[model samples]
Target: MALGRNISPGQGAKYYRKDDYYIEKEGGEEHKLEWGGKLARDLGLQGKVDAETWEKALQGHFPGGVEIQGGSMVDPKTGERCHRAGTDFEFSAPKSVSIQALVFGDERLLQAHKEAAAEAMAFLEEQVGARRGHAGKTWETTGQALTAYSRSCWTPILPHDGQ
Candidate 1:
């Protein structure tokens, strides 16, 4: 009899077996990544979260941004495509000291970042759409939400002049 493992919907996030983990990425199929196992665990992924969770939250809820899927990267300077591997994980908190804000605590940072990034993206898309002759782009909400999101995330943690 051949040895096999039953597959589950969310198991695609991280398939584990025999004290080893089988991690499948978006383009992992193209890369022919059969099994990563201990060699990958040694690299420090720690299996905090899964891809499907993050993907469903971001794209399904509020789509668009840099399009970080399938392990592909775009060169900013020359606009070229590149292949990149690995997962980006971080634990975030509310970063606020308010009583009401304390309710959410630190668990909302990832969602906050993803949501803000999505709003910013949607704003840009709408503006571009308007320029291309599309209608229904509202500047009011875009100015508020998109700006707040950008300022909150990309705040200058440095001291310098615009010179």
Candidate 2:
């Protein structure tokens, strides 16, 4: 299943910097970052998701004359303020699949899940947009979705194990 939530200003760092809930590996832990959507490439946001770049992206600070101050963007047309930021979409694997991957120690299974999630996110990016005016005008955007793999293993028992 997939879930999503809004990421407020200053909170964008949590997604890229923190790896508290991700899977652990030998020697150390690792998390991969990938930028999704057309705007991401246009903005030259490749490799990793950095805090400064993410902050600018969150504030709609584009190259075409958008101004950001006090964690908000000033609309160039009407002088209105826009405080909306990014959205976090979490794509999770089914419990049976997760347990199977963990128990069998199949990295390929995990990779497959990650790829599936990325594909789903790509589809979602096409549907995302930003509002333009008071008359319900909206335009398509890259959605600036950052994709990564996450696993939560802190619980004593896996919730879907039917304990």
Candidate 3:
């Protein structure tokens, strides 16, 4: 039988029962033991195990440590594909681009990703261009655009009002 310790009332009491006594003292309180009606000998579970042995036994039940694999739950017989979504497809010239841009591990794809990210950052700059501020250290984009708005400045390099 899969027995467990009898926890005190309101102290993990739900996970315990008086009949299923598995371990010894827990959190400065020893499990409540009763006789006649129930005992370790009566349940035929008089075997003793140290904390180290019990811990080792517990590890045997879980594979790949503690984390449960999400994809492991899929039915191999039925499940075939997984899908991903995106807001807009970048790295190309298109009026109001709104499609998925899937990328894989390849030099060409990696270059495309860099270009796409730059294009996105440029679009963001157009919407909200850099402003004048004060800071010792500043950040800059790879290209001569999307510069951080820090230090003495005059006017904002605003972009034309267009989508």
Candidate 4:
């Protein structure tokens, strides 16, 4: 199961841990950087997501002299401010798959799920649009989004006889 929602600038802080708990819970196995596309790469937002970089990216502050606020800049960069900082996405495997991975200690199963989630995010990024131009004469343009693999957890509920 997978779920996602737009993240506001204010809510960005809460997500900055970048999977620490998940890593600890998963026996110190770190989650891979599987999302964030060309835009993120071009902006030099790489490796593990740090709080500073995450915040900067959310506010449209990028390297090589580019600053975007409210989704729009001027002259060389033009667009209106975007209310959303980014999207919070979660991709969960079925219980059986999770159990299989856990029982066999198979990293491949988790990797497959991450890969699938990345593909979905990439596709959505291409289809998503953002507002541009001044308020009165605004237009819609393709949106560039940066996504980080925040965390993953599996808490299964099973019927047990209290063995």
Best of the candidates, lDDT: 4
- Model 2 lDDT tens row, 53-140: 5556666675456443323545434566656465567677777888887787778878788688768877886776555666777665
Q: Worst ten-residue run, lDDT, model 2?
A: 154-163
Query: How large an RMSD does model 1 have?
Result: 18.0
Lowest summed lDDT window (length 10), candidate 1: 142-151
> Candidates' TM-scores?
0.21, 0.59, 0.18, 0.63
- lDDT for model 1 comes to 0.31
TM-score of 1: 0.21
The sequence of per-residue lDDT tens digits that candidate 4 reaches over residues 18-105 is 3443223233446433336667776776665555555676666777877765532222123434466665666788878988887877
Model 4 has a clash total of 9
lDDT of 3 by residue, 1-110 (tens): 11222112122221222223423444423333211111112333223432332332222212224321111122223453322110111233232221222223245544
* lDDT for each candidate structure: 0.31, 0.54, 0.28, 0.58
Ranking by TM-score: 4, 2, 1, 3
List, residue by residue over 1-163, the lDDT tens digit for candidate 1. 1122222223322222112222235434222112122322333323332344333422322233233222344533346664422222222324452223345554365456656545544454354211222385443321211111111232213443221
Superior by TM-score: candidate 2 or candidate 3 = 2
Task: Show where candidate 4 strays beyond 4 Å.
Answer: 18-35, 70-82, 132-143, 150-163
Q: Give the TM-score of candidate 3.
A: 0.18
Poorest stretch of ten by lDDT in candidate 4: 71-80
